[model samples]
Target: MAYRVQGVVVREKDAPATIETVIVPDPGPGEAVVDIITSGVCHTDLHYQQGGISDDFPFLLGHEATGRVSAVGEGVTEIAVGDRVILNWRAVCGQCRACAKGQPQYCFNTHNATQKMTLEDGTELSAALGIGAFIEKTLVAAGQCTKIDEESDAAAVGLLGCGVMAGIGAAINTGEVKRGESVAVIGCGGVGTAAIAGAQLAGATTIIAVDIDDAKLEQAKRFGATHTVNSKNEDPVAAIQALTGGFGADVVIDAVGRPETYKQAFYARDLAGRVVLVGVPTPEMQLELPLLDVFGRGGSLKSSWYGDCLPSRDFAMLIDQYKLGRLDLDGFVTERVGLGDVEASFAKMGDGTVLRSVVEL
Candidate 1:
């Protein structure tokens, strides 16, 4: 039987999202139906609405979600009905080259539900990140559901489905931060602050947070930053170097994804150290650097896609840390608003008034 539920939809580019009734088909082969409990209002959703992602009009706008498996289709055996899970965008195809090579994080072929959900008028909806979850129920490939502890707050743990996971994985997976190391994170937004928390979890002795906004810098400290640098008033590169004993940090992560921030991250790392770019850069942006400086840096320059995360492994592990009270997942939830307030939450996101304004379903 088909299910009808209200979902947030962006009908046209730059148009405000509207709440409309969507029809969710019963689970098809290898698919599962999830009763979504909560979803996070992320920048990606806003980007999708603005046509920044693609021309897939009538797009379903949320992906970071936690839910319970209400039903499963034929051939689905991993997750049973009533299982608590977090929905993930990356559903690795084990046969893909990346997965076959034992690096499923870069799975060459990811999967989504074969079936499509449509409007009451029968218009197909392009789900954001292949997991449209800003509704009462959503359908996705069984692999997209990562089961975690049910005791944890869904609003908090669901964030691991997207941005928070990206930030944490940028440090622990892509950056490979180590104990006793000195680390610096550029941009104190949600991702950067999560990187700071990841560094602390990895036991980094000196964790420096850099940002133009003093308020965000303070939030970064609450997320485990040992030092803060207001980039607008000071030179971030020099400040990071000074904080690391006149030598640059061992690892520097650029979370803002701008050319200037990338340059700062490049020059703010110690010789033979690593620079990780976890920020999503705009298509028109370009970087220019001297070849001599590139050679002189003598370290790795890497880009992290979705924080190079392996959902099945990283999600559960991080949830365990949260349950142990080691990770401050709750701190990331600055506000909880209903589905109707998602547009307003986007405004707050632009103003930097909240770390994350989650949409409680």
Candidate 2:
């Protein structure tokens, strides 16, 4: 049997996302149907609305979500009905080359539900990141559901399915920040601030937060940034270097993902330090650096995809940290909203005042 529910969909490029009747098919052999409890409004959703991600019109716009497994199809055993799960796009195929090398986080082959959800008129809806959840129910590959504690706050834990996880994993998994190390993160948006929280959780004592906004800089301190740099007034590279006693940070993460910011990150780290790019850049953007300087910078330059995270492992552990009061995941929830406010939430993304406007079902 099929299920019909209300969901958010962007019908065309730059069109406003609207609530529509979504037809969710019964789970297939390796699929599971989820009843979404909470979904976070992320910038990626806005990108989909603007046709930045793809030209697939009538796109289902939600990925960072937490829900309960309503049903499972044949051969689906990783999750069961009544299990609370965080919906993830990284449904790692265990047989992939990366998985074989014990790095499932880098799984070369990931998948989503073979069956597509669609509109009442039979137009197929493209699920954003392959795990749309701005609905009462969503269908996904069984592996995309990571079972979590039922007691966990759906709004907070659901964020782990995307942006929050990307940020935290950038610091802990990709950056590999160590105890007492110095780290600098540029861009104090949702992801960058989360990186600061991750660096703090990883035992980094000197965390520098750089951004063009003073309000965001003040917000960064609550997440464990020891110093804040308003780049609008001073040079971020020089500010970060001075904060680290003129030696530069051990790890510099460019969350802005622009050529200028990338260059700043390149010049803001210590000689043998690490530079991690967690931000997503546009396709047309390009960066040029002298080969001589690239050779002179002895540190590693890395780009983190989904924070290089292994969902099953990282989601549960992070939730546990949230439960223990060690990580303030709740702090990331700036507000609780309903599905109708999604477009308004998108308009709010520009001012940079809110962290997340979570839709609680």
Clashes of each: 0, 0
Model 1 clash pairs are none
What's model 1's TM-score?
A: 0.99
* Regions more than 4 Å wrong, model 2: none
Candidate 2 residue-wise lDDT, 157-257, digit = tens = 99998999999999999999999999999998999999999999999999999999899999999999999999999999999998889999999999889
The digit string of per-residue lDDT tens for model 1 on 1-361 reads 9999999999999899889999999999999999999999988998898888899899998999999999999999999999999999899999988988999999989999999999999999999999998888999999999998779999999999988998998999999999999999999888888899999999999999999999999889888999999999999999999999998999999999999999999999999999999988877899999999999879899998888999988988998899898999999999999888888999999999898999987
**Residue runs of model 1 more than 4 Å from their true location after superposition:** none
lDDT, model 2, position 159: 93
Name the weakest run of 10 consecutive residues (lDDT summed) in model 1: 275-284
Error of 1 at 153 (Å): 0.5
Error of 1 at 113 (Å): 0.8
C-alpha root-mean-square deviation, candidate 1: 0.8
Candidate 2, number of clashes? 0
